[model samples]
Target: MTSSPLSPTETLASARRTLRTEISALQALDDRLDASFHSAVQKILSCQGKVVVTGIGKSGHIGRKIAATLASTGTPAFFMHGVEAIHGDLGMLTAQDVVMAISYSGAAQELMTVLSVCKRMAIPIIAITGHPGSELAANADIHLNVHVDHEACPLNLAPTASTTATMALGDAIAVACLEARGFQAEDFALSHPGGALGRRLLTHVRDVMRSGEALPVVRESTPIPQALQEMSRKGMGMTIVINETRAPVGIFTDGDLRRLISREGDIRQLTVADGMSHNPKHVSANALAVEAATLMDTNHLTQVVVVDDHGLLIGALHMHDLMAAKVI
Candidate 1:
């Protein structure tokens, strides 16, 4: 039978109540953590093979997320369906592997079947359940309790607060393992190469800087008009003035050209060196593009030169290049 719709105030109140209940469940789980959690982390760290996370129903959904989080954060892990294990997918298990089985009630028959197979294969099991005394938890090598005092559901029948606690516990374990492994942002970026963090960490100056023929370069003795022409052709808003060894000695930008024009209206005889900003800012080709962006922003520069270890100009970077690469 359809129930009457809740008024706006009642709907908001119900949402707040649900959030409060889940928050309380997470708090209880946090307070209850003890040595077992440590043991679970040590087991995972010591495992020679991947972590196989398995579960059924709603727990399975949470298991998939936990497995993904673990995998992305330096702990090798993948999700397995508990039901499929007994139906011949148990071959995925190895003696070196650790199985993380999620069952809120700690009594799923499929998980029990997998548990027995794990025992026979000498595979370690880490069980996450709401009932610490339940059969699965009792038989497992390690047990993590996700017990909740109440469900967020009005009837207390659906997996609401219990699931939230279980997910939070899974995150806690993943984060603990991540810290133990010394997982850093660079490591995370490797696993998530298409993400924003990956772009920021993995993209180097050499990858984004315009090099070779694209670089707008002129000799220090080149006329100001010639330098401006090169800058316009390259569309970098600036030109690098190089010495005899092709080392950047100064930079001539459109802003400098405008200021020069404003200061000296008759600049037809002036060379690039006369108007260029000496000791131009430069970065190493191996530096991260994000670092270059920081340098540019800090100096209020529209362009910066890329140089090799010996201070020879290898390339140039414009603010627009960083914007195009999405590094800024």
Candidate 2:
């Protein structure tokens, strides 16, 4: 006889139970944070060289991610495979470096070997394992216990809850180290320069906006036809409607021009004030490009005026500028 497929209700209940078990495991992990965690963060923060993270199998995968997180969050770190470290990769270790070893059982031969080498080199060790009394934990300079009561796996043998707890603990360590170093958003953006998030965080409107002659600015008293001429000359698809003092009070876009021509049937009768949208959304030149994008999106506009704190139009940016800057 073949095993029957689980019913929808049974499958749903099983998934919910697994999730609940993992949640409880994470809560236990959270409750266990204490001086030991603080010491680990301090140790990582004091490291003169890069953080060397190593582990075997599933733990290795988590170690890789932890190393990446630490590296991106202000701590310099890299993952060295435990087994490979015993080979030629041992050269990656230095006396100034700190080793973070991960093993659920804490007795993996490869990890233990690397730990032994680190000990001989006088490198500091931070151990993450379920077994607090195992050789790896006992020998480590700082031991972080990642014990979980149950696995999310039905068989209770696979690393489910344990890995989740380990990852969360790793994130906590990274964040703590980040705070200790006073790492700022600009530093994070530097690390992620190739990603869209980096562009959004690092770029300001002033960096991408069109200023001076490239920006179309016209007085409210200017005729609609002249404003249209200014829009064409600047080729920004919009012109800033400014007051006598050169402060932006409105904007006239291609859309606004089309609507006016369609509704009035004669463009000669309209002035810049009549065709322009009053009190248009504006952004500061120093604001993050993402914030400018948000303002444009919130106002249903393809372009927005960039102003200084005094409400003087300093520059202008089109949605295309954000796309070109990779801040979209």
Candidate 3:
């Protein structure tokens, strides 16, 4: 049988209707939140082993994403296909593990098979399902109801709003468990060392800063020509001016050099102290590279001096250092 195509107006109207339905479903899910949500979080937090997320078909797809999110956010988790569990994959489970079973109907035969094993092993089960009275939910230690009045699908047959609600609930549980465990950004960075956020959270000023001879430094009263040589040797386009005790008192940059030349300031008569900007921005050696980047941007600087607690210049870092380190 041939079907008629929708007009442009009809197509737009249908799309709007779907969005509205899903939004309404999410609002309903939000309103229905109560003690069970908290119970689910507490159960996962109390588990000593990994969270094993299991489901079949579309639910399985959502379960995999939920498991990934949980694992990435400090909760140890993995996705186990519900059917795979019954077919010898159940060996992955331990008494300490928590089973997060997903099923819109809460009556999947494959899930039912694993639920028994979970029970026998004394493993806690958190059920994410639309039907609270179904066998899976009835047997679960905590039931997270993801019920929706209707799916975003025009026929109301596809898992649309229901899956969205389920995924949102799963995220809520993961974040709650993360906070309860006192999971910090540095801890998260450890698991995601290759990502930009990992670099920002894990990298310190000392890790990326230029120290020793690589740091361009000049005594306070050094001649401008000598400081220029130091900057050229270090190739940082800048140099720190230090006092008698080796404490940074000022900074001179390539920009300052250009301005001095433009103003016809006598380069031969100038000292590093006369050419430098007093009390330049600096950061602690232990400060985050990202924080250093922020200070650089805020101060309109390309480089900043790294100092120790005693206010002695320990190192310096150019903005390029942070960019190369992927801290910015």
Candidate 4:
């Protein structure tokens, strides 16, 4: 049977109550944190093998997220279903590995079976449960209590606030380990290479800069009209002016041409050097593409030349290249 929906006022009140309850649970968990939390972090840090996080039901779902957070933040971890662990997945564990088992009641039978195997193998177990007195907590090398006074569920039977507390505690653990290991953003980007942060941190100017025939190049002596043709052919809106040694000396842009024409009223007498902006900004090919983007933004430039350490021009980077690589 469909129950009557809550009135708007009642619905807002209900949402507020849920949020307040979860916030209270998190506050309580924070207040209750003690030395055991430190021990858990140290154990995981000292572990030579991966952290195998296992649980059942809602705790299992939370465990999977916790495992992923830990993995992405520099810890090597993976989630193993409690039932699967008993039926052959336990082989994934090693003597050097650590087990992080979660259960609100701390009495999951599957977890108990896995705990037995961990005991025999002398592997350390870190337990997260709402009950510190339960067998899993009592037997674990370290116990983290996520106890809440009551769940946000109207019936107080659903996982609600307890699950929120569990997930928050898991995040706390991951962040602690991350800080302890001195994990940096570059390290995180390595793990998440397909993510936006990865693209920004890992992509270099050489990886995205136009090179070879795609690079718009012109000699300082090249006529302004011919330089404009090179810019159009490359579609970069600008052409790099190079000396005989192919070192970028200046850059001529569409804006520069328009300004020069407005001032000179030329009858096609000017060379690129006559109108080009001197000392064009350049970055080493090994510099990060994001760094090049920063340089462009700071200087109000549309393009920057890519060069070797010796300042020999290798390629050119237009803002469009950064956009195409999603590095901007």
Misplaced by over 4 Å in model 3 are 1-4, 179-190, 259-265
Tens-digit lDDT track of model 4 for 1-328: 7899899999999999999999999999999999999999999999999999999999999999999999999999999999998889998999999999999999999999999999999999999999999999999999999999999998899999999999999999999999999999999999989999999999999899889999999998898778888989999999999898988999998899998999899729789988889999999999999999999999998899999988999999989899999997
- By lDDT rank, best first, the candidates go 4, 1, 2, 3
All-Cα superposition RMSD per candidate: 1.3, 4.2, 2.6, 1.2
Q: Arrange candidates, best TM-score first.
A: 4, 1, 3, 2
With candidate 3 superimposed using the best TM-score fit, by how many Å does residue 77's alpha carbon deviate from the native? 1.8
214-300, model 2: which lDDT tens digit per residue? 999998889988898999999999899888777889999999999998989888977988878998788999999999999888878
Distance from true position, residue 271, model 2, in Å? 8.4
Compared with the true structure, all predictions reach lDDT values of: 0.93, 0.92, 0.91, 0.95
State candidate 3's TM-score: 0.88
Q: For model 2, give the 10-residue run with minimal summed lDDT.
A: 193-202
Q: What lDDT is reached at residue 79 by model 1?
A: 94
lDDT digits (tens) for residues 137-165 of candidate 3: 99999898999999999888999999988
Off by over 4 Å in 4: none
Give per-residue lDDT, candidate 3, residue 283: 97
| Number of the candidate with higher lDDT, 3 or 4 | 4
Which regions in candidate 1 have their CA more than 4 angstroms from the true location?
A: none
Give one digit per residue, the lDDT tens place, for model 1 in 135-192.
9999999999999989999899999999899888889999999999999999999999
How many clashes does each candidate structure show, in the order listed?
Answer: 0, 0, 0, 0
TM-score of 2: 0.77
